[model samples]
Target: MKWDYLLFYRWLALNMVGFAILWVFHMNGMVEPVFLADSSYIVYVIAGLFLYGMVLCGFRVWKTSRELNWVKRGDKGKLKEFADKSRQSDRESVKEAFEIKLFARISFVKYISSSLVMLGLLGTVIGFIMVLTNIPANAVGDAAQVGKLVGALTNGMGVALYTTLVGAITNLWLNANYNMLRTGVVNLIAAILESADPQ
Candidate 1:
C-alpha cells in the first residue's frame, strides 16, 4: 500500500521549472526572433499542438493524482468501482480494465507528440519549395533581380530552419511530459491492483 502519491505533483513541478527557464530565455530575446522569422507559421501550429498536449498531460496527471488519493483514503472512487466490478475476473482482466480506463484520453498526447515532428518536416518541405520558387530564371543576367533573389532565398531558409528547430524541440518537450504521465498511469494501475488484493 506504500506508494508515492506525489509522483504526478513532482513531475508537474519539474515541468514548471522547465517552463520558467524557457520564459527567461524568451524574455531575453533569445526565442521570439525565431518564431518571428518563420513566416510559414508552421512553427506556431507546432507550438499550439505542444501546448494542447501539455494541457492534456496536466489534466490527466491531476485526475490520476486524485484517484490515487482516493485509493489511499479507501474511498469509493474509480478504482474501487473497478475492483468491485472485477472481483470475479482474473488479475489480467482487472489490469486490462484499469489500463483501458486510465489511458483512454491520455493516449492522444502520444499522437500529438508525433504530429509535432511531422509538421516540422512539412515546414521544411515548404521552405525548400519557397526557396526553389523564388529563384529567377534570368537572374544570372539580371543584376537588379539578384538582391530580391537573395532575400527570398534567405527568407525561405529561415522558415525551413526555424520550423524544423521549433518542431523538434517541442516534440521532445511534449514526449517528456507524455512519458511522465505514462509512468504515472502505470503506477496508478499498480496501486489500484494492490489495493484490490492487499495480499
Candidate 2:
C-alpha cells in the first residue's frame, strides 16, 4: 500500500550515470562505436544499455539479499515495509513484503535483457537489405567494377555477422545474470515471508 517516494527517480539517476559513462568511453574511443558497420553506434548503444540493465539487476539482487538477511535475523529497524504493519497480519502482508523488495521493483531488467537480442536481429536484417539492394549487375566487361562490387558485398556480410555476434553474446551474458538474480531473489523472498508474519 506504500511506496518509496524516490524509487523511480533513483533508478533514472543511476541509468543516466551509466549512459554518461558509456558516452565518455565512446567519445574517447575506449569503446568502438561502429563495430564493423560504418553506419553508426546504434547497435553498440543498445548493447551498452543491456549491460547497464544487467548491472542494475545485480545491484537489486545484492540489496534485496541484505534486506532479506536482516529480516530473517529479526532485524527490521530500517527496512522498508511493503505492507502496513498497523493492519492485521496475514499471508497478504507477506505478499506485500515481497512486492516492496528491490528485486520486485527492478524486474524490468528481464525485458531489457530480451530486447538486446531482438535489436541484434534487427541489425542483421538491415545488413542483409544493404547487401541485396547494393548488388551490382554482372557485366561482360569492366572486371574492376566486379571487384568493387565484391568488396561492398563483403562489408555487408561484416555488418550482419558483427551485429549478430554482439547481440547473441550480450544476450547470453545478460540472461545468465538476470536469471540468477531472479532465482536468488525469489527464493529469498519466499524464505523471508515464511519466517514470520509481518504485523
lDDT per model vs. reference:
0.84, 0.63
lDDT of 1 by residue, 27-118 (tens): 99989988888989998899988988888888888888778788777786777777777876776777786689788868898999999999
Which one is best on lDDT?
1
Which pairs of residues clash in candidate 2, taking residues 3 or more apart in a chain or in different chains? none
- Residue 52 in model 1: lDDT: 87
Deviating ranges (above 4 Å) for candidate 1:
1-5, 88-91
Candidate 2 local lDDT, 1-199, one digit each (tens)? 1332233334445457756876797899855635746363546767678768767876775665566566566676223353344244665755655556545566687788778778778778877877777777662267867876777677676677667767776677667666666665665566555555446
* Per-model TM against the reference: 0.90, 0.68
